[model samples]
Target: MTAPKPRGGDILAIAAQNKVNWSGLDQTCINAIRVLTIDAVQKANSGHCGLPMAMAPVGYLLYTRFMRHNPKNPEWFGRDRFVLSAGHGSMLLYSLLYLTGYDVSLDDIKQFRQLGSKTPGHPEYGVTEGVETTTGPLGQGFGNGVGMAIAAKHLEARFERDKSGLFDHRIFGICSDGDLMEGVASEAASIAGHLGLGNIIYIYDDNHVTIDGHTELSFDEDVCKRFDAYKWHTQVVEDANDLTALSKAIEKAIKETSRPSLIRVRSIIGYGSPHKQGTSAAHSNPLGVEEVKLTKEFYGYPTEPPFFVADDVLAHFHECVERGEDLEHAWNAKFAAYSKKNPAEAAEFQAALATDLPTGWDAELPVFTPKDSLATRVSASQAEAAIGKKVWNLFGGSADLNESTFTDVKDGGDFERGHFEGRNPHFGIREHGMCAILNGIAVHGGFIPYGSSFLCFTDYARPSIRLAAMMELQVVFVFTHDSIGVGEDGPTHEPIEHLSSLRAIPHLTVIRPGDANEAVEAWRTVMTHTHGPVLLALSRQKVPTLDRTKMAPASGVRRGAYVLTESAGRPPEIILIGSGSELSLVVDAKAKLEEKGKSVRVVSMPSENIFEKQDQDYRDSVLPPGIRRRLAVEAGAPMSWYRWVGLDGEIIGMTTFGASGKYEEVMKHFGFSVDNVVERALKLLAR
Candidate 1:
């Protein structure tokens, strides 16, 4: 389809227009993005340039003509969100952000991919003002956009009244063939379609070019048909540069408010590059010196001076600032009136936006005692019920393992089609997509999102988990069946080395509660934590709660590790450390060793990461240097225990897969028993 002609019937005619907004200045602004992208990538001598050049018109139309965003206030809650899911084209987003009057400066664009520069290799969330979430990991951002759509629907249901649209912002994004090909994106798309997330509108960049070669060498499915199968409102703009067609497609999508929309834009890679357009050559590399000049000439741009933006194009894009201010000003006025009518809901909305925990949110949390012998997962469910009631904005679900993971809230209705008011979202069996979506919800603000799965299944969600840690998102990841305790499910279900591997991720706090009360405290810590993602590795098998009347209070969980019980009247000769279900073993072993006239101290070490953050004085007080005989017992790999158990200490942990049997039998077979703990402590003392 051809672009609609200007009023004077010429491509370069300077004329005003209506909603289509087709003009020579619009084309100039679009080319400005293309040229700036080429300059940034060419100057860096690194980064992808193809998609930016190919989809410059697509991106320009969204930023300037369609998307309701505030360039000056990027965090305006009422503004629509735009995700560059095809984030390797970071220069594309940078150019749009700069031209549209965001905080991104010309020098920042010049420092693309440089250390400490806002324009990093990928579009990061906090580093750039307009970037909604971190991208460049392909399908992760796709899942994130769906998550944002979910968040929007949920907030709208809870807060909006009388057709007021305070929470009616849409999630706009540009995805690619690589993104669609990723398994995570497929999973996320399936759920988004199922939930009828009408707030999402993603443009597929069908440029057919990958780093290895054209996508035909790998991807060849009918993308629009596939989305149709997923219940999406699908459309295709045969020409990427056909502005009139693309605009109409998007307008039609906005009218269809029952399904998410996907508009396939058949584009050419390196759209205007003289030598490399429509080829793999321009996908990831700089267009070289001569190709750069030729490309500028192709766009009718000056060749010598790079990163140049015409004054008219700048002025054209800056119009977003005034438009955004007007839009926000009107919304603010409506919100002020809405606040008077619905004062309680308005305050709740503001608190959620600030991520502030309400007072007494945990007032109802259970304090388990020795009489309570329950799986940590079960305790987590109980704690969630109490916190969910007061927190009000705690949203999450399990990966089709709600029955086993025990993350479901009793009264929290299922978040289904047309019922987004429910807090418990059913994520089906998509672990990776669930985590990526949780990141999206967290980054979207006004909600604390979480997802749960079996500990062994976290391997499937590792990439998203790593991204969450990288982004420092406030997401809670709950993983049950934490060890050999998975029992009859056998080695495939058990998580060996999972704890140690997860601990290796920076900014991620991994906690395995020793008992029911510690599980509650872990939830408390998770609710208060704001810096990064936290993973709770809970046990499926029952473990006895410590009698806090006789032992240290469970509040010590905030300290990461504490002396649950120490040798009576003296410094302990031997120290026993454990976490999760294994904590019970050390508690029993400490009792046995004390019977033999040995001074024994038992410490509950739930989170090594959080513990390590403590001051040296507090750390020394917990594990006094004079005592070197330490024994650490757990059902997982011993790699993470070596640091806690010094050269003279011993760690009793699994070196092999667990057997299929009862949980108790399986645990003993893996040497996670009280007898094993006692034996290891004795040997350490003898040494």
Candidate 2:
């Protein structure tokens, strides 16, 4: 049986006890987190107050009692990572960060949800010192935590190579009821369990209240049972307010060391406010000024002082700064000893930890000639395989499409329970889960994670990809079957608008490599460019590798767009532009146009994003302002080509969903044919 809910006197007695056994400090810190959340929400007049308010005890226990994180150096490799998967309740994370003596200040908290403030509406990765990943779309953080746990396991597997206890930290996450309800979380949870990621521990805030009303109106499944089905170690803390049970549950979870653990804590939605407590009203929206005052009095807090943080509470939390520094220092010393014993492993470990790859890491990337048969996906796989061999930190997998996507690092061990040394992760068929997991891997550091699936499946994973772009994570996304060439499977599998849609997301580098050599260069660019995630759109059908000797070398793919074949004359009358599968089509048409005495320039524009980043002079030199007459060809949507073709030019592209046919027939059925392109270019030249 669980302890009964404490009455007013019992609560006060618990709070007033200063004895070391039940020292009031823990309660004070917990209450401090609750009050800070309430005050910040009221000030913002727009925020989720219920979760932070209710889960304060669990959050307090995890931060003060369990996690080994350095507030002074948030990037310490040895630190235990904490992800707030229930990111709408960002105040929960912000309050902990501020209380723990991170760079987040009282002023930052005061400016919550304001412009130019570190405390945004959601937990953003780079903007806040302690925020691990950007999460607001419900379950991305939960999936991300799974990725982090997997990364930790991979690190131990690859480097530890023994029963040595170095790199023994875990990943902790605070998730909401809504987080568990999201499909991404379910997908990630199942994989984590299947892989037996013992380092993952998630505390589900089982408030049982959704936005519409009671979860009974919609969500009513035994979450613990569901997790058990997924093969996870599970527990339920009967009371959200019970600190001792929470601590014990977490400690037990840490000891299991075989399966991921899920501790579901039942709690009131809004704890303190008399009117809103345990209701959906408390879930979002701020308590009124009067309700705020009433809530403070109810929690035994001073109503006069808003955002008040107690000194003893502050001191207690600040100890984390010192504790973290000590942990990192000790780990550093151990690493030094480890380095002395195993110099090669130590060097590899340090290099992985550092974001930069070794000099000339891409020196061995394949350079293809025309003789290298239809080689888009195959070439990408070759380049990635070479990278997987050299970089200890390079790790990733496909979303059940490894064979088709060509993303499997050949012979790179498959990551699973009891096999941590493997570099490849089996994310299963969960594209959404796979991408979010990659986000977790990226944010966790020490690894450059990539994920692959059919280009059409980007729809399933767009939310996580958006978060990756928003956080500017260095995740490489390998998307194959860039066009209607997916064939046979018909319209559903073919990606028409995916290219335009992905290109529009800010900070995302979308590169549709045209052939084998461009695919190699695209991977090279992804390694050197660390600002954001790079999306590589590879061809499903074989695209002939344009011989580098006769045309511009594929190395120009890094420039985004390059003049592959120039007109017989200096200033070409017309320019032919293409990306991915269509570049070969453009090249074929360039031959036809050249035969017709039309001086044409063929430009292989792999990445519009990178090309746009080029200086105007460089851009003009490649696309030239003098040539208004241009023909752009792409098997996908023509929206992105408008800028290059100008208002007067034409785009030989798909006008409808592709017909079910062979890849060649599909390309021909759509006007991507050579005759159509030559006919279009002749008209453009005449105009």
Candidate 3:
């Protein structure tokens, strides 16, 4: 394969000159990765083993030569990120992480796919030290790589000055035919290429095989041309085993510097497996005892030793430890010099790297009063603008819903080709990509990312959001047009079961603010939050700002639920509960019931997950014992309300999709009006 002409300086020439021939040590290292992968799957009696065998050379080259990483301190800020998008071949990553000494022990590899083992079915982020992000659902890690690349560029632009390369590093990934086929990767690639994120270089394991059959059966398109259309610089290495050609392709990708790079490395499936090589059997099935012995013989490995690590092979791979230590030490020296030269900027930069927000960042967050003009509470579009002015770590954008979703960071500018320092990133119409990119930014660290779109599109973004929750990423998702209040656009645009569907994801915090002050508190809770991802579902219709002087302060939102209006007497006879746009309807209905001298209570539950975390005593106090006559209301689906309202309690929620009409007409038609709320309360009391 001829080398592509480099567009950068003499760096390409230097890299090519430094490249060495495929040595005996290199082959041993590559074979080690392959054998470890083979042994892992054979021992576990599960997992895909072919892809690891095919991509061993690329893995060896990246970990030992091309990638910049410190395995000892896997969280080192300057280290390059490696994402295995084809995570079914997780043993490959596990092998590299263990060999390079990132905390995965030999025992972990021996226990692949076992319960309570670090080596699970997939590479989970926090469970393993060197695993940068979780991967299992195909294409998620592909899009995550794009997000990491975008974050790297943004930080480089924001903090780098006068050759202080404090935040300079690349994101590398190995994706599969399955990963590229997924729509999320396509969405992320379009935006990544459009924005000229040149720091990403992914190796496509073009092995022409999948779980079902050869990719030719289903996927038969010019992948290189497709990426070219996305403005990516694409290359192909016919032989994945050719170290010289693969190294040249990677060096040129680094030097291209104006677009993301994809190096399609064609490789043989199950290389060295005498019978199974290039066949579907090698894709997932373990080579039987006889076949495994023959395969080892082909590679000249010892057939008797199951998990052998030759001393030389171990030394070659562990060289990464010393190399990494030196690399970080050099960067540390430069960081010290940078700190001395720019003290204040350096201090701020350090704090950002630590993901620390100023103690006062949320101090002046907006406080809405009833006397304040009524407005759509979801219009907290100003949330980022309000907190971002003081905390620079807050940076994000929307998927072309910028004006509508209210997620724009004003004056932060658009994160485009030449102005990556801008906080706002225009994600175009790629909602799935927007969510995945936000996960990337949150995992990349130094930035608290938030992405927005209409609530109905949560279907498109659910997979990435699930991964964020699984990884416990600290991201904020701003979903606007929370309910059918997004009228005139019809049922297609409205979300009926979205609230319940999103709440289904574990470790995800869903907060639907009731009014303006609650919206303010929602954003405040997000600003200092350091746990899993949080979703703020805001409204599009006008919602009344409550009189806090007569009700519980909006700060009660943090507790997930509070008595917005308590009963006139202890142990209320009946309770009315609501959240988001329907909250005011219940508030109005409570007043109507009180006029009849019946004891009544009004509850605003913005977040069910947060409320679940509250002590049982707190929960009982809010809902209380003996108050079995409960009427809960919301504009969305009500399945999740069963736990709070009890089996005997009644819920006022939509049974069907919404209709297109004026906002007020739609609310009245759906029984979200004050009259319907009072009527539901009365009916529950009569029961």
Candidate 4:
């Protein structure tokens, strides 16, 4: 592997000018990114080398020339967001972070893909300084980018005055074929187009290669055409190697303020590799010592040097860091002047960024007594309207189910292209896009966002949900018409596996409240817990509020699961457990069993996930180990109840799809009734 002959300075000049050296300065910086990516992957012995090698020029042009960000204050609200949606090429992002003087260092790069290191195999939000969102799952980053774009537009609308572009910022993402192929991206793209989010720009690395040799093996759809179908503005760069073309394409994208832009950049997978430039081998595995050496030598890098940075190249890259800081500082000064000029606007801006809930925010959460009757969905809407009034930053929309889900913010106007200041978002029938954009809004930082649709429709947003959990984003998903109670909508609308399935995700909390009061409690719980995403599954049918005087207080709802009712004496002959609508059944069953000379206790288990998080003493207090004769009941699948019900327990739940009928008739047909609950409890006690 011999160095290419000098084309333009010293040894550094020779390496930088190899090819595509449009600007000597730009060339040095681009090569610095390329070499850093190669060396990082080579040192770590793991990582995808193809994307970083191929997409370095685009990334270089964006970060160094276009994107406005501060390396020093990574959390700066005014900085433009850059998401590497093709997270497999994390090395590319990490390399840029290291060179452009973000908090990431050469040592951090050395620790790539290692456990406990900030530089993981993929970009992780909150884990690394500059990582916008976690993007290991394909297409999730693109969806998140949509969310960020929405955030930028909304913030700019709310805060940016005519003379002062106070909240102006752009969201940039690098997506691969995998991102375009994923359904979440399509859903998010459609919504982005509909919303006219011009602040967003996505660069597609059209390498046409996947893990399975070639993308042609399975993927052949025209991505540009598809984006066009979604009503997005599109452009194609004939060569990824051409920096000038990439720069001009980005400028055009920035110029268009009516639509989001996608720049399809064509390039080889492993740009400078000697043997595996366009093959599957370059996708994940190392390029090997000989091939890597040859690639570095071919680009005029010193053979003996590893992780080497030429002073001039380092100087050129540091300019980005300086420029980023200056941008932030300039914004800060402008913001300070704006605050003096318009105290009211400045206060609103500061208040939103503070993450503080408005005073008396909880005043609107209607308190329900045992005598009240209401559906959890209705109760949730009441709570939402109350919170929405106090927390002005809270914004969201439903998937054309606002009336059904009760998710509309009262008096809040729709978020349109021209009206970003609106609190309510009309997402139409796009559940997937609603979830993705909620994540984007949350990622944008100032707004507390939520998305709503039927519980069954959660399937449409599953990928986005998974990404939200992975990113530990604080986006809320309000899923109404939970369980068979969705009724006349029939089997098609009912959510049989969704509750258990969403619970299966690692960092997501799935909560289903039993009544109006518990629904309020569920809302309170979701607001207080900020570590990850929360899914609120609400019922469509009215449920009687649990009698607080006769039962445990609604406060225990925060415990996930708790003893809603206690036995008359020391320990009960049998324990009855239920969640959501079925909790009412257990409450009624407890009365009949007690009348029949059986000591019975009913526990309202709203959230199994949160219950599991409690300490054993608390859990034991709720469900004592001595009580083996327990019966768990729910309207949906029964698979999740075994952990609480014990070895001798029985779960009276739906093992099949629901029937078409009224909600009450459906419940009766499914055996989700007091009679069935009493029978199950008696059988357990008899045993």
Candidate 5:
């Protein structure tokens, strides 16, 4: 094969890069993949066909030879992970899953992009049996692979000391031009290189065709040089069809046990399509019936039967089923032997795999008192350190905000290149990549992953955060400096609407603790949460811890909201609600209101998301139906409080960006003061 002209920098060539002959069976299987992909897109009438057509050889080679995955048991603990980073080319994954004997059937392929089908337009994690993580919004899967690699490294360090090879699986993926162009992927790639995650190996399909036309229309960076600069092992393959070259590249990548690998392969977009071979037309649109027939003729395939699979091809692919079973059986035996020698470690590993917290995992959790006046972020840090000691499976770090976010686990060592045994991972300043990586870690299992940053910076990580909620991963997202309380940093650092915006995402639990004790309870809830992602928006300024002896216990935080102090001798004539740092205002205001001979109730509502999940009777009990004279106070957008506070009620919140000053000054400026709360409640009661 002739080499393409070198782009910007010197091409990093691989060893043993020579022409290796292919048999009829290999060629037939590769074409079967191509044929099935095109047929699926053609039938669906809406999907990308070009990538599958172009990268069939690499996909076939990886599944058939390189990857140690069991088709029969997609969730086999010892199986290697395969991420389809170029999720737009989803047909490539579905076809492979179907062919390799994963639960995906030919009928599933025909149902591509159809409602309720396992084969969605993009690869969804739980929807498909084999898909490792959800991918589609370009570069997310790339970051996810890095996370999986990190998980593998950590697990291997913890459990593979006996050389049982139980946790030594690698992460393989196929990425497209769009993926590399995305900032998330770039950030993830840089970190992967920095950490020297050798278990990750991704093949870049340099087809040069995107939905907008050729990649040259915009992207023209020297990808190999860039990766090399990131400290990754890079290589170039002139032809995607050169299976031998692809094989050798993968072999070299596997042997380079210190750095991640990116093999860039140049190939035609729509490999066999005669008319639109290298153009954007083939990138997303289906190959028309006539053109498909012409493409099939090019592959020496029968044109009459679309989605046809030869007997030899099926026979060849089904081998993975038996091979996978044997692989699992062997690993089971090794695990049994390891268990005999190390029963405690074996049980711990098993418990982690089952996502079961150990006995007394919460035994050491911090319990705060009214005397502990501290920032919620500080309390959260104490809670994490205590939990981190017992729940060894809880692993994560902040995105260059460790000090600010107060997410450091006390004695937990840093997770670095050579020290994968550490539980704390320094995610640098890459919030976008950090959240996506956290999702990857959560999906990989064996760990309850979390990532932190200032609440305002959730904008950088929103896409991944949304996906985490969508996938229903049990991830804890800790965001500190949650409001204008991040004073002097001004509006850019203060998260004015962040709480409301995060609450908008379905299945995402947003918790902003009212005080130190509540912060500890919030962490308790976070550790026990299993359904979906949870975001903890903690305070940068200290909050007076409510005296549980005089008020409702902090355990009420688990129920999401509770009445802190109830009215005496009557049902409340006026109700006061607050969350996070503003809870103090309502507490103070309640005393002032009672002095006016009004029956007042003060409720500390930390998490509206969790409260809404309670049954009607419970919800009504917290915010009584008769009490329309209610006032809600928070240092954030009032949008989220509308449901809790009736139309007759009022909210003390920031309507404009906060000014740079002391936190107290900022709060007073934004009308988040006790006087404001008292005034609002009086007016509502008068009405």
Candidate 6:
């Protein structure tokens, strides 16, 4: 059956017209999104369809009118960011990208929710053009948006001066009830509000329906009131179908320069669905052909058309491209004039846009010798301070652990609402926000960012860490008081599962440096590697520096695992493996083994993630395959060593939490001493 077509009209004419009189141009464009979403899900047989159908107009307005972005240059630094916090509505994002001349194609849209398609079930950061961040796990995108807003403020403060709006851009996000309900969002929203990030605006799709039926079933709270408590500017639109109201609300949001804005736009779930509108059934499964056809008909769309776009609708969207180009051109002209006036600042701006690290950055890393007895956290602080002096773009702060984590750079000023250009940021006691903010800073580019907190509190930062890994961002995480060696802090303050749990993450680099020298090497490794996020787990107590003359050079830390002490003979009968503070115990065990007429090799495996990246030849060179006799020691979980120690090997590590006692007493009680390591090694060797 052929679909009916309507005549052309102006925006006012279209808005005034009733459902029956509505033009095919308007209905076709909206229904195209509905049809493509349903078809894509039907093809892949997996995905949520309700969100795209309900929020199509929101996506349409942002893509066809407001956002200033170039699909051709998705990585354009000046482009506005769009984060889909409700990632289940990925089809909505994919469809918009396809129509807006982004890299996403018709074929990509059709292949949605399928393997190898750029349009994944959820928007992945690097995999898709125009996807600002990888968002799944509710509330993360909210935090990510805060990070982007913070970045915008920082950049504007640093680059935009005297009629040069170099970094004047907004960070917009589409959030849902689920996103707002997550605690991380609350944490991020508080910080964003406290910082007065006026450039960040979020459109809340207040669709009363959720996957488990009405949102009232699980979530029933005044969202506007919650945001208001965070000191954010809030607004409400009674109807999502009212485009004029949305446009006006967005304009108001943009105009506000004192606080972040949250425009609560009440929308019905499955807006066009004939029967499933405002129902949970419309949230995930595809509307059947009959239901979908009825939905199109209800929206005054052609009944049989699929992925069809009217000429006027195409022209309407083309306005966005033209407007964006004009904006970019105006900004470019302004920048040219600014460059003529401020030559040095312009050069710095260009260098930052290029994302180029300073030359000879490694030369600034602080080094330590055997005579030095310093905590790895202290070393990290010194190294970071030295690096910060050379790299002006480096910026970050701690989650109220600046003193304990030693993350504060000397002489760096705090980043405040009026002083975003300052280098240091005090994230207060919010760990989740700090991590999410770091991810934002890294994603914003031109700045190398790091966040710090006690290792035990990584649980609070885990969600952000996962998002950073998903985005493959280069944010550094400084986690101090790495283990039970935190002494009097008790089990609650000591981290046991953190190192292993962090190591389990696919793209995260978890490095637990043994001493001051290794800590310097670890920072160098972090500065050079851009694959993903890096976590530096440091000890609270001071550790003696390893003897480089008798042990492997600190540079070996880059290899992940290296031979710290080699056997004098052809090969050692037993191998001892350790990391961080435990390496000292293994070194002592090695000496004891040699005195007992046994040759032993001591290996330091600081970062299992980096070690795993090493070639088999290098791995075998460090831990020869022939030496089946091995013993692994670490203060944390024993489960992490089974891979390094083969079937016949033994691991001496804590299987449970430590007690409240002195660090030495806890180590002894947990059998983490040199005597236990030597005993375990002898047992393994005898076997």
- RMSD (Å) of each candidate, 1 decimal: 4.1, 3.2, 5.1, 3.8, 3.1, 4.1
- lDDT, model 3, position 500: 90
Rank list by lDDT:
1, 5, 2, 3, 4, 6
Assess every candidate by TM-score: 0.96, 0.96, 0.96, 0.94, 0.96, 0.95
| Candidate 2 accuracy as TM-score | 0.96
State the lDDT at 652 in candidate 2: 80
Candidate 3, residues 511-603, lDDT tens digits: the string is: 998888888888878876688999999888788888888998988889999999876655678888899988888888888888866688889
Look at candidate 1 and tell me the lDDT of residue 85: 94
Q: Kindly list the per-residue Cα lDDT of model 1 for residues 1-687, writing each as its tens digit.
A: 222232212211211121234777877888899988888988999989989988898898899888998899999999999999999988999999999999999999999999999999999988999999999988999999999999999999888899987888899999999999999999999999999999899999987778888687988899999999999999988667778988999898888889999999877778777667767887999999998988787677788789999899899999999999999999899999999999999998999999888999989998777889999999988998899888878899999998898787778798999999998899999999999999999999988899999999999999999989999999999999999998999899988989999999999999999999999999999999999999999999999988889999988899999999987887799989999998989999999999878999898999999999999999888888888888888889999989887887888888888878999888877787778777878877887
Which ten contiguous residues of candidate 2 have the minimum total lDDT? 11-20
The TM-score measured for candidate 3 stands at 0.96
- Cα error of candidate 6 at position 296, Å: 0.9
Please, what are the lDDT tens digits per residue for candidate 4 over residues 445-491?
88788989999998888888887888787778999989999889899
Q: What is the lDDT of residue 451 in candidate 6?
A: 90
Q: Compare the candidates by lDDT and give the number of the best one.
A: 1
| Residue 174 of model 6, lDDT score | 93
Per-residue lDDT for 1-687 in model 5, tens only? 222222222221221122337987898898899999899899989999989988999999899888988888888888889999999999889988999999999899889999999999999989998999999999999999999999999999888755778888999999999999999999999999999999999999987778887677899989999999999999988878788888999999989889999999986777777777777888999999999988898788888787899888999988878888888899889889989998989999989989998788778878787788999999988888888888998899999988788787777788998999988899899999999999999999898999999999999999999999999999999999999988999888999888999999998999999998888899899988998999999999988988888898889999999889977898889888999998988899889988988898889899999999999999999887987888888888899999998788888887888789998898887787878787878788777
Task: Give the alpha-carbon lDDT of every model.
Answer: 0.89, 0.86, 0.85, 0.84, 0.88, 0.82
- How far residue 408's Cα lies from its native spot in candidate 1, in Å, is 1.6
List residue ranges in candidate 2 displaced over 4 A: 1-21, 161-164
- Measured with C-alpha atoms, the lDDT of residue 165 in candidate 5 is 81
What does the lDDT come to for candidate 6? 0.82
lDDT of 2 by residue, 586-637 (tens): 8999888888887889998888899999999999999889888888898888
TM-score of decoy 6: 0.95
